[model samples]
Target: MSASTPFVKMNGAGNDFVVVNALERAFTPDAGQVRALADRQTGEGFDQLIAIEPSTTADAFMRVWNADGGAVETCGNALRCVGWMLLQASGSDKVVIDTLGGPTTARRAGPDRITVDMGPPRLDWREIPLAEEMDTRGIELQVGPIDAPVIYTPGAVSMGNPHVVFFTDRLDDAFVTGSGSLIEHHPLFPEGVNVGFAHVLAPDRIRLRVWERGAGLTKACGTGACAALVAASRRGLTGRRAVMVVDGGELDIDWDEASGHVFMTGPVEVERTGTLSL
Candidate 1:
């Protein structure tokens, strides 16, 4: 690692992260190394690790890794975090971030508020990396008790990241705790899964909680908000655009009709910055 390279610590809602750039600096963070660094007990840990690199097509490339050190695609919060950092560093308000899944656009809506064009949601089974082919609209998934199910027929959507959504009568921990574990480890999802339990309110608002794949239950998840909107829209549960209230904060989401893309708007907070040595 370089002696004088700068890094940033940022968060979207409450999903905190530690971000560094490989393009501007020089550091290929190994999974073991990343895991070690993000371990709160051992180092300056965080929920996720965001690495920014140079992109041939877009303004930059973004690589996302869970606290467990597994690299994944599309982080709504991380994208906004990157956008905020880019704007602060480059004085530009618009950015395109290329990831392992695809490229996404982030535009600053206002000071501390950023909006991300998260591309389209994939409903197909293969796109979600399900182990077997199944209907994406409503899959025959059940958990908890057989007769009295905790979750049934979850609506699946991929916001670059995999999310399995369960629409509930209300938002509570009972449902989130019972069903989240089963579906996340279900035979179908090869890459594991992020689980969301949503309760619709007035068709224009939703109450949501997320069990992130590797990060466990976080206060909020940006991709989870995007996935919930996609799932609700497909199930005829809500309109294309609505506000989601998570345990940490709120996010505004819109599923575009023409382009079939999902957009998430929220705030990114920078807490502090520091460094650690292995």
Candidate 2:
């Protein structure tokens, strides 16, 4: 490995990332390397590491690694951040990005803002890939006493990534961290899951926090917010479109009734540009 790699630090709704241009230099860091870069105390520090590589179909291919060095299938906030970068570089309003999940298109919504067509939310049991067959709208899962559970019958959805959302009136940090950690590795989800605690504030608004599968807690989680909206809507707790307020900021999520695709709109910030001594 060379020690002359360059990278850009960027964020979308405060979900920070370290982005590298693998298309130019062809650098692919392994799990250990990714962990070193993602460590907040000893490394460059980011919620995720993004590699922008060449793609045969789309404008570019995006590879994502969580802070724990686990590669994930998709990341909505990263997609928006990458879209903004590619748009700035190519001087185009739209770009198609290829991911392990599938292809998605992004367009400029405003100055420094992006709108990504995240596609449909997978609501089927086989799609979320639970360990057993069950209804995704409210799966057979609960925490606390059997008779009166603290969180029960939560919903599951996959926006190219699996997520389990629990609707509640409280947004306790301890509950989110502890319960999220448990459900993230629970047996019901064979592939593990991103656990989200959503507090519905109104029919068109929700407050959310997420413990990412391999990233732990984060300032913002784009797909988590999207999943929150879908789960809330399916349960009639909220409308199909709503504003998701995360710890870092807010995002507008809309699950189109006609198309079944979800659209996420948010802002991206460029923190700094620097080179990494790999």
The best candidate by TM-score is 2
lDDT by residue (168-270, candidate 1, tens digit) is 8645676576577667788788889999998898688999999888777777899899999889988899999999998878999999999988889999999
State the C-alpha lDDT per candidate.
Answer: 0.84, 0.93
TM-score (C-alpha) between model 1 and the true structure: 0.94
What lDDT, from 0 to 1, does candidate 2 have? Answer: 0.93
Which structure among the candidates has the greatest lDDT? 2
> Each model's RMSD to truth, in Å?
1.8, 0.9
Find the 10 residues in a row with the least total lDDT in model 1: 1-10
Cα lDDT tens digits for candidate 2, 20-130: 999867877889989998888989999999999999999999999999889999899999999998999999889999999899999999999999999999999999989
Off by over 4 Å in 2: none
Q: Give the worst 10-residue stretch by lDDT in candidate 2.
A: 168-177
User: If scored against the real structure, what TM-score would every candidate get?
Assistant: 0.94, 0.98
